[model samples]
Target: MTRQRVSLRQELPLLVWLVIVWGALWQDFSPGNLLFGALIAVVVARLLYLPPVELGGRFNVLRAIPFALGFLAKVVAASFQVLFLAVVRGPRVISAVVAVPLRSRSDLLVTATGHVISLIPGSVVVEVDRSTSTLYIHGINVRDADDADKLRKEVRETEAGLIRIMGTKAELSALNQEVGA
Candidate 1:
């Protein structure tokens, strides 16, 4: 029988998260509970083993700090702003799908941008054109083309940070230059 080796990179962190979640869910540690937790851990590890993009593997935790903090602040502020618009202004307020041309070449950055947009209350990522590197985002409160453009810039910055965290500084710099041009 060939021995299956588990890499610490792939297994340890997953195991920790599993254990913490398991502990929270079950106050009593019976045999069945232990087995269930182990099964859950195995399933999670299996899923982690097959990530859609491998870019997150190189994620620099330090570079991610600013993005995480900024994302939280933006989300909180946007939530209230969106709520106010929704409550005060009826559905007559403008909404449109704007195409944002992505600067970063990495699929991870593109995906991250889509996710961040979706997380915000007023916007949703409808589609991403991988070949053209453009994001189609539906904005509920977009007033004009300028608003759409501003949203695109914000998304680009957030995604650029993700690229930097994933160790693509050179690629991101080139992308930034292209955007500037």
Candidate 2:
């Protein structure tokens, strides 16, 4: 098999990202640093044997706005809740692991859902079952069945939001079918 030639247009983003990272690492934005960074980025981009990652689906920035805001809200709210539970009412906290059945079967959607859920302070992704498209989330202050169900619902909602923002049309159709939306 013959090697594919790399195009400048294709490598442009990667080169720019590497240069930014290098400048940040040195804590200097001087022209000299930028030039050095560019040189390094060029070498790395050429020598690095990293495989191309296929990011499937279209990204809708407009749809993602609400999701981003919701994520921030969840993070802030969960932070306060965790703080209250840990500081104000220490030692009485109850935690449980919940299994959430995800609607989207795409790996990108599943991984993004897990990462977003885990970013909130009161919950974390303990395990992911790709075969079943299920996420085992460990949640703080889970008292009983009702609490577990609530957490599961929250994860489902987050997954739905993520699907709307970045999921394929097929995934969206599947989600709509599942939820009757």
Compose the digit string of candidate 1's lDDT tens values, residues 102-172: 76666867877788878865788888899988999888888898888888777777667767777365775
Off by over 4 Å in 1: 1-20, 27-40, 43-52, 167-170, 173-181
Q: Looking at model 2, report the run of 10 residues with the lowest lDDT sum.
A: 49-58
lDDT of each: 0.76, 0.84
Local accuracy of candidate 2 as per-residue lDDT tens digits, 38-109:
998989877885644334446789989987887899889888888788798798778999999998777878
Candidate 2, superposed: residue stretches over 4 Å from native: 1-46
Residue pairs that clash (backbone atoms under 3 angstroms), model 1? none
Residue 89 displacement in candidate 2 (angstroms): 2.6
As a whole number from 0 to 100, the lDDT of residue 105 in candidate 2 is 76
lDDT of 2: 0.84
